[model samples]
Target: MQKLSQTQFDFIIIGAGSAGATLAARLTENNQFSVCLIEAGGKDTSPFIHIPFGLAFLSRMTNLGWEYDTEPQSQLNDRSLFWPRGKVLGGSSSLNAMCYIRGVPEDYDRWNDMGAKGWDWQTVLPYFKKSEKQQHGESEMHGADGYLSVSDLRHTNPLSSTFVDAAEQIGLSKVTDFNGPDREGLGFYQVTQENGQRCSTAKGYLTPALTRSNLTLLTKALVEKIQIIDGVATGVKLQLDGQSIELTANKEVLLSAGAINSPQILMLSGVGPKEHLAENGIKVKVDLPGVGQNLQDHLDIIVQHHCKNRDSYSISLALIPRYIKNTFNYLFNRQGIFTSNVAEAGGFDKTQYAADIPDIQYHFLPAILLDHGRTTAFGYGFGVHVCGLYPKSRGEIRLRSNKPNTPAVIDPHYLEHLDDQKVMIDGVRRARKILAAASFDKYESWEVGPGPDAQTDEEILAFIRKNSETIYHPIGTCKMGDISDVMTVVDSQLKVKDIKGLRVVDASVMPSLVGGNTNAPTIMIAERCADLIKQEHK
Candidate 1:
């Protein structure tokens, strides 16, 4: 470990999350340049993080997770939704459901259309392939040998297969591989796992690179602000163990602090809207209006059902014996229910109003997820998560107070747009239809949520308003765009506008949210970003 006393490096990357982990590992590969990776959270030594099924318990771990709550949303009956982001080494990748989904090609092409040049699907697919070590071997679309392990689930509940079968029975085609050419269909989801264990970026990238002398990793170091001189980022001010310290970046200061903190850091460092900065008692340095704007997330609502069959995995007194057996099974052989990623199966489909691509995504869980898996329901049941992939609503991340310890105010402005409400309603109605298919006739008992009483559009909308929660994919707060884009915080190369030696290389730099999960796309972004940085600095 490099001591804090050594306060300078060729590169300083903040937030040891998905992007930072990848960038740090990739940038230091040559050993010609020294890199520093700092994380606000402690080391990812939690045993639960490495277990696939441990997601059930990881959400309640306040220390390992950034358990942030959104500002009360007016559209959702004035409810504050909880969003759990990973505060560990791999960031959300360590805490996420482990679903390895990349959005459709058109999703990235849309970014090209939105002024993010060189980021079209054709151009970005290489980066996606570059970081993947697919279990099924290499294809034109997948890499066989790479850092991250992408594979089929080691064990999947029969209920998960039933969900796919139910979708097929409802006239939906069954897709064997979602990351292949076609993305719209029902199928089992591949996960970021290796031999039934989670393969977080920390496992794929950081752990291997730790042996290299050029890389320095500092954990539990909270970066309070960026030090900008003459509109150029030179270093950062971070607090560690109640002591403040400063570290200089000889070449560049890369902000890979995910979506929320990346924007918060930018704003705190005087690189946000001038007016908001003044109100927060921050000195304006760049006056960029797009620092925390263009916030987007997938708000999902689940349709739960009561299962008549107890064979399926669910919470019940009868399952205790099975649970004990499964625990032993996992400890002995690393197989069984312990290998399940909860949301073992899912699919994507376009709604009637979708524009050229699928607009709704599904995550079929063998067990019900209540309160983001915080509350345990006492019964054997299942849930189908329905989310509008292309949400029309936009929100922002703003400073509640100038203090770095204060959590930023996140207002997703969910369902604020009328189209978002309709899409979510349609998605739920579609999910209901799939669950009602004849494939589940034997298991069907009764609808546990929104029931038959919530049939009409109004009733369904009301149900959604009351029960919707974030699917944990948030992006586009420090959006990348063309030079002409007035709201762009970073250019196409991810360079902060009007600032030298600074870049934002994370989900926040995405011009728009992808069609599915954000983790895979974030890794791809960092893969390409590492190349960009090396090419520029070499």
Candidate 2:
């Protein structure tokens, strides 16, 4: 391969998703280094990109999402699952439900125990604070001024508030903040919004960073592979505009390309398991088999129920006029139904016994979501999303072939661990208990999904195994630990242990899946990684 361009950048960050954009922005602040960020997706300019409630619609919108699905799972009735990842500048943070969750403190403490230095609760807290700006004002646990927007929803639907009040009726406490010092009980969620609009990572970090001359962002460019010379990452091979091009990295090459693509890129570039590469007819750059192991994600089994009144959100021709009004208000006044993030409020709670934090989390929807896409028939219903916070399940990602655009073998291997199955079972049972309680009976007319028929532990397990789907919080592919830890792909500083000048700084590096939404924690990881890079240069 010829050296197409002689220019070299101090840093080249692949996949301008959540972590890539963030790191590129912070690292270029010094103006002493040039940064190049490459993203395969187009710009984040869609109207739904800023609307909170529009996420339900965006998941089906193929233009903005990377509609990746997992291989059939043995545990889930052999069902193939859907995985919607944002392919744009902000990544999933641009298309997600906008829920702001920092996970639990114990999540980071476990990282410290696994030899990931400076990743404990105390060390990571500042990074979280630095990445976000809490609307409720700063406290010891929260920050006020930061790149990411964190604010309470403006037009909170009445039913969501009623749901919270009903929880108190059922003797469940209404904890203010799940990301606070203590994590427990049900509460209204603090969303990643700014004045009734979605404030994505691109809007927060990359957009502003574009003003600086040191930062160069290239969209609609796919990173096909990393270029390694003498076991050192030197550049990248990418495809854009119907042609392939090569670019060099002067200092370091960072792979913040999420879990699925990051590991796939490493393997495609000959840096994965030696045997797998040999079988696939690719020369092995390194024999790091752990490049695509330890995949984990939350599985949510929705329980829908018919409502007694007209509070449900069912957009029909009859309601199209109302939706039009709501959309106008969002564009002009920045309020109304468009501002309401339907997956508004929920929390974590222990299933078996008393504990400081909750082992399970809930996503309370104000409208009926029968399936992935809106069908010709519609009804009035609300859903309770039950998920296991700390799942013991583990999966792996392997290269399907050497092709860069080829989808990898993503095996969530959900419920492979018996304990994970138990937790999910308990989660379903607990959701039923909540719906059956007096709080739910006050407004709920009928049990729709996994209804009264799906009873008993066996029935619940069967229902969960058949109907459950991922919450899109996959992590732990390129993990970090001591060098001797054979399963870990990165060291404490996030560098690939066997390959020099190459590192992966994304959710893929998370050794364990964070107990809550992966968005906030993913941004925090970028802040922490930026510090590591800065200290090394100093």
Candidate 3:
């Protein structure tokens, strides 16, 4: 075992992900403070991570992500669903579908109403603009010179456009931009990409910051726990290449390990619920009851169909020639089928149960996606993924053991509430109507999932229970709230309650789940937190 000569830094960031990478880059921008970013996984140098279409195969690669499985959900036929989170330099941003969506303003406004001060729609909008570099240039709503590139997809399947038209045919408006004022409509989603390549946080933020003299990056380092002394976080003890090392944080220890790991790290550090810690045989440091509670995620159900036309993406002997031709097109011009994000088009709309804002979201894929795209399905087909935007059901993440490496027991308790189940049924029925529209008449063949036989509400609910999965947006494990709330782990400023020099800067700090894709919102949270930290230090 070897010991490091230098063991101190102004800030120590755990998990070099979307939030961590942004914080690391922003904190070290002035070179006045030193930062150390530690990641459990190795570098994200894989071609699959850079190429947009390569997302189809990312779920199968175990090394790049923590392939977590939820505990058997009683509400979903007792199925333990797969949950994949990136462990590499860019974290989930490198593995995500790259949909750059910031949910409507009401989402943030609700956060403020829920006791998270200074986090309303108007207050957080600047942070969203500050972190984005829109392809269409600067505006009141977007920034042109940000580090994270946001651009239109260089290529998209024709069926994606048809899906938009189908929505319009059903009286839904064709929204040009989902981020604009009017968000409830169908549209082709702009992605977090540049020149047809995925612009992960590793590419957009961390890569440029690597040359800074005051910044340090340690990959393949497993953080065992945070070291707290007298109710104050001092440093972290980690295992690096079979060697134990301790790195002290002079200013603060920022936990950006996302929803699951961030809370798990705090628990492992003995800063969680007293009873749970005692049960695990670990000495409790801070008895915070909300360390791993208030778990929220978007549960999705897919409505698939067989397409008579061969235009949809399919793996077969007939398409091999086209794939070969498109490969060269992408290599030379950075265009063609290889540039498609697969779930290229989507929409937001209100259901019968919605009061005002959209209650459901859609992601239309020009191919068959079964088992999180892990299972290969041949022939021409398409699918529309429907998910209720706001679910009342809540779940928790708990420690299975005292060991840091042991994966946490995740139980989302999806559809535990009757309202969530009803919304999902409505969402599926809405998707069926869109597919049945005239715009898809030429290509549509037959329903593949929740097929013609499952038309009734009971049948649809049963199908949802048998087939639903997470849309990869888990959050609120370590929620930010007012001090009066006993379950609140962190405050509005993101500092842990009653713990000095410790903060959580990730999706884990969200008080409620946003209405759309979470990648852009997660980046926005870090951008706002960076300024808050800088102000405090100054």
Candidate 4:
């Protein structure tokens, strides 16, 4: 295979993940400019990857995942749970369940408040629209023709209608679109899928752009460090197949390497906390304290119940043929339960006494998820994953050493804030209320988790302490805000403040966590960042 020796690409995108793929696609849409995308993972060619229901299988497979384990979380009784990220073309987006959540409208409005200028709902909404092919069609809140397709859950389970009814019974308002003008209520989830298949950024953005003559896609090229010269990014040193190679950036280098790797790459290239680097024997090029700080993740605990009579959607010995039929249906027609995004349906909501925005997000899965991210679990049970959207807990990501191959120290100090634990406890209580509603009475036999007898808040809290896990949404490793935000790596335009010709465009740039799933917003950042890069050159 030939290697890139020229330092003349119009743009060089690091990490062909959600944001990087979109950036490469959008920027290279024209034939005039050359765009190069380098990914450490090989091609995304798994059949399970395209099937939404296959999320269960793929979540456990290591080929499509950069499976990471957190350092023991002392707050959670010292458990180092798994954290899987996509290493393939669309990155995590390809491996993820493909939930299409834009978070709260106020989230963007608050971004404007937090010194992220022009990122308010009105300003950012167009970018969201530009990247969407909504199932609900174009409206005041959605678009019809975009790079990504947003569709309703075609494989709806009986548990969905029951969950919605139970949520309403517990006083949560029912809604249709969680990403609409008003974002406070329970509703059917819209996913990033097309014809029942997962619509990853590789399919949505990169596929079309790859046809462009100026675009280049390189797989298995691991970026070791950004090559900085006099406080400006000039190129990068990449290690490919045990061989070191250097490639220059003619115009600019965009680090869409995601929250974890972007900051890791920056620190390895000598551009982070001075003392931290010196301690590791790496000379500091830039003393940016915020290079890998302000990490946030949505923590959730499942509440399970054993159904009585024919209530729970558990299959039977008689249902084996149906399951087999659905499997073949997905293999051939790309439709059926095999395409089920187990989080079949859910919504955003908050109690009356809760904060202004919807603080709690829900994930209602039809299957009993005994352990999270597991391809298979026992029993015909269901899970209600309630998470605090904007948590008070703040964590950080730091380098273990200067080695790019060395996984960074990812510590998401979960439940560090006493308030965060309290909020999560309250979130668990709310989920229990919905589960215990009259709508759920039909399914009630025995409480599968925490058991029906443990009703006190303390028991609920204890259950959360024992079983709560990350919902796999991590952000804020390179938060973007204002100059006063001395700890921040990127400014409002997402440019590395102290480094020229460099930008970080991934979940890491989120100043604060959004109210829902991060995939849609991450791609939106790429769509917007593409214009920002072009404007800089023009």
Candidate 5:
């Protein structure tokens, strides 16, 4: 451990999240390269983190959550949105809804067209398949021997089934597998879990690699800045247990600190827009303007309905016995309400205004979720979340200060574009139709939010402006593209532009936002990145 500061390793991966965990594990598999994985947070041993249903309580666990908030959105009545990121070993993978969607083929093809060469559907599909251990068995579309677990939820509430049935009743066909032949239908989302527990990257990759002799895993290590000399990144300056240490990378320094931290680390190290760095008292190392630009995220609108049945989950004195039973059922049988990842069922769909693909996504929860689940309203209820997949609006992540602990300035600028608002309005209307179907008539009493009275487009628009929130998917701050693109921070190979021995390999490097969850794709990126690094040194 003492050699971390005195000797250089083959690679140093920052942020131990999805990409960092996968990249570190894959890089050390051959026992040829020594890898060091650094994480700002401690271990992923929190009892709430491993339980699938504990996500309900994770939003409030500040120790494990990097609870960030966006600047007041001008289009959303100047309301700041809550953004929860996992700060533990597995990163957001431990804090997410655990949906295992790889997005549609066109999503990657769009990346190819956007100047991220060799990242088209066909080229990237293999990586997705390579990293998955699907419970449904192996096929051309899925892998069975991979490390990450992909399985169907052990149990689902009846309301989730109703949501699917209602979607089918409205001409939206039912799909058994969203990651299969088509992603344009309704179904339950397969989660990243094994048995009844979560299979976060920390559990999937880092745990196994911990026993490897060549791998070094550091926890509670805050990386202050990259130690860049001339044009090459030599190492990183990080603080661990009140001690300042510098870890050198013999081969390369991989920055996988996610969308916000990745760009912030870059800028703090003097590798961002020259003027912005100068304004923040950071000397310019490389004037890369796209270091923290082009941020993309999904702004969700939730429609809630009061429940007519008492059996459904709710906060009530009468449910004390039920809660106790469910707890024992989960502890002993490993199956029950506690095993449910609140977002039990969800799917992707296309509106009439879609651009040749599914442009809308729905996450159906059997329980009410308000204020990012921060404010709980008593009584039985359910919610359906609707989010426009691809937003035209872009934002930025800037250094709030030079301090490593200082949070980055996140401005997602949601709904700033007129088209984003229009699509959301359409999404809300379609969500209402799904709820109105006969399938939900048995349990649904009435719409509690934006109620039945708010029917006009102006009314819907106004409702959206006041209530839209983030769905926790953020990407593309340090975008990857060809050299010709001025806004590209990293090249097609993920190398930091004009900088040697440095690379950005995380969601931040995504040229555009994928049509689905970012965790699976982020793991795939690290898998491929491991190959790239290995080939370069081979």
Candidate 6:
């Protein structure tokens, strides 16, 4: 144990990612309120973070990520899947695909129905609008004057457009916007980009507010535990550059360390299940049984093919001249191949398991992506990533030990439920159908993943178990619900049920997983939390 020196602020926010960055910026708007935003990783200075197409290389960079892995899931052929979470200032938003999706209205409405009051579509829509600066201008569904910039892709591979055409050929309607009223369709995805660069929360919210006298940003600071005295979270104890430091928050200690870290922090602070805490040699405090339970994530399987033409993005000697031209094009105009977010086009569709809304999602990449883009395939190719939107399977994050630096045991239990398995099979079949459409005749060649041999339902299930990986959307660890629900870790206000001056203001508080990407919705949660905290303090 190291000796600590104390520092104080009006609010101390853990993790300077999407939610924390937004909260730190919004809370410090009133000059009187001082905010300290602490991040485990260094600054978002990586060129890969800002460059839209750099995500392919970004996935392989271990320095910018938490570098977590699951506990060998049995359903997935006993494989331990890698979970890369952003450790940088903007967090995962800086490392994500930059797709600006806010799921369907029913997603939030379901949250309200699940006991999260004031979180329905109508109540939450304003916060979504408040956080977005839509390129198409303001409308009933969007806002034009917000911090995060959302724009249509300036550059896309020809194969991506062909994918949209192919989906249309397979009977899926062409949709201009997935965020609008009509959600079920295939089309190009809008990205969180401005001109060409990614509009991560660090760029959109934190960077502009850095010069503020009231805001303090700390990087490479790992929070060990919350300083909870008499069941009230007074501050946090963290390790900064091999030295221990205690930060006190006069108003509140906001935990926006994301889904994994948020719950892990609570458990480290002795706020988790009593039995589990005792096993890890931790003294019990709140004994919240739901601290690390109810973990859910989107598991994706790729349907890939070798392209007959050179239109797809790939590493080949034949494309050297094109690469050189694209390099200069990006350097001068911020356009060309470098401007493309690999998953350029995608769509939403309902499987047989779905009732009304889309239960399966597709991300069409004009390249051969393997191992989250960590493994490179040589030849020209394209792939469609498919994921079951609503997974019936549930997993949990548990402590490896009482130590904070030691990575937590993450078990997503992917494809544990029969319904999830069935949904994934349907999603893969839909993707294959679109790829086989007449529109792809010019570029399509032989199938790469789950080859032609995988034809039957049993074979498809086996292929899914062998090939599935996370699409990076994880939520519901510190679930929010009404008082009647025992699993509710936080209430509608995001405050810890029995703790004072503490709140979990990130994706963890979602009652259930949203229909699409979690980044946009996570920002909205923080935007709403800032207002909730302001009202109480005012």
How far residue 255's Cα lies from its native spot in candidate 6, in Å, is 0.1
Misplaced by over 4 Å in model 6 are: 1-6
TM-score of each: 0.98, 0.96, 0.99, 0.96, 0.98, 0.98
> Evaluated with lDDT, which candidate comes out highest?
3
lDDT for each residue of candidate 1 in 1-538, tens digit (9 for 90 to 100)? 3366578999999999999999999999978999999999998888889988888889888999778999999999999999898898999999999999999898899999999999999999999999999999989999977799999998988888888988668888899999998877899999999888899999999999999999889998899999999988999999988889999999999999989999999999999999999999999999899999999999999999987688566678878998899899988898999998999999998777788889999999887777877887667788899999989899999998888889999999999999999899899989999889888888856897989899899999999999999999999999999978789999999999999999999999988889999999999999999999999988
What residue runs in model 3 are displaced by over 4 Å at the alpha carbon?
A: 1-5
Q: Across residues 1-538, which tens digit of lDDT does each residue of candidate 5 receive?
A: 3345334788999999999999988998979898889999889999898999888888888899787988889999998888998899999998999999888888899899999998999999889988999998899899998889999999898889888888668888888898998767789889999879999999998889999989988888999999999899999999988889888998899999999999999999999999999998998999999999999999899888887687556788998998899899989988988888879888877776797888999999888777877887688888789999999999999988888899999999898888998899999998888888898878846898778888998999898898889888899999999988889999889999999999999999998999988899999999988889999999
Q: List the residue pairs that clash in candidate 6.
A: none
Ranking by lDDT: 3, 6, 1, 5, 2, 4
Which residue window of length 10 is worst by lDDT in model 2? 370-379
> Against the unseen true structure, what C-alpha lDDT does each candidate score?
0.91, 0.85, 0.93, 0.83, 0.89, 0.92
TM-score of 6: 0.98
Minimal lDDT window, size 10, model 5: 1-10
Position 179, candidate 1: lDDT: 94
Across 399-487, the per-residue lDDT of candidate 3 in tens digits comes to 99999899999999899999999999999988999999998898847997999899899999999999999999999999999978999
Tell me which of candidates 3 and 5 scores higher on TM-score: 3
- The candidate with the higher lDDT, 3 or 4, is 3
- For candidate 4, what is the TM-score? 0.96
